[model samples]
Target: MKLINLISPSANLAELTALASDDDLLLLRQDAVYLVYQAALPFPGKVLALESDINWRNITLPAHIRAITDAEWVTLSANASQNLLWS
Candidate 1:
């Protein structure tokens, strides 16, 4: 089953990423985007950043995480058998 992890904030991103499987995807939102910007987390699977969030903060999209639209986020979540939210 494909699992999507939503990383928000108020948690240890490194530890959370460590628990991820190679097949799991990471969706960086809110403050979690900072980690990717800093090149902190080398998640095994695909990494996506919420487009609106990044733009709202006036941050340039990092190479490590692709920006996804709200519609795409819905599709991604729908395709995943499991979704984990961390904040």
Candidate 2:
């Protein structure tokens, strides 16, 4: 199944990255957006950030990570077969 993982906490990226499978889609939100600047790329799958959260944080997003809208977030949630929330 295609899984969409919502990771909102600043910590746990490394552990989650190691645990995540290729079919998982990881979307980092809240404090997790800060990982874009660090070495925490959350690779092995599609890694995205919530644009609203990024704007609220006033963070300058790196070119590598794509930001998704609230509507898009809902769409992604609806499209996924299952969801894994890691906060």
Best by lDDT: 2
Per-residue lDDT of candidate 2, residues 43-74 (tens digit): 68878889998999898877777899999988
Name the lDDT of candidate 2: 0.76
Query: Runs in model 2 with CA error above 4 Å?
Result: 1-10
**TM values, all candidates:** 0.81, 0.80
Give me the displacement of residue 9 in model 2, in angstroms. 4.4
Model 1 C-alpha lDDT per residue in residues 1-87, reported as the tens digit of each score: 355555565577677767787878888888766656565565678788889888887888767679999899888889987888877
Best by TM-score: 1
Candidate 1: worst-modelled 10 consecutive residues by lDDT: 1-10
Pairs of residues at least 3 apart in sequence or in different chains that clash in candidate 1: none
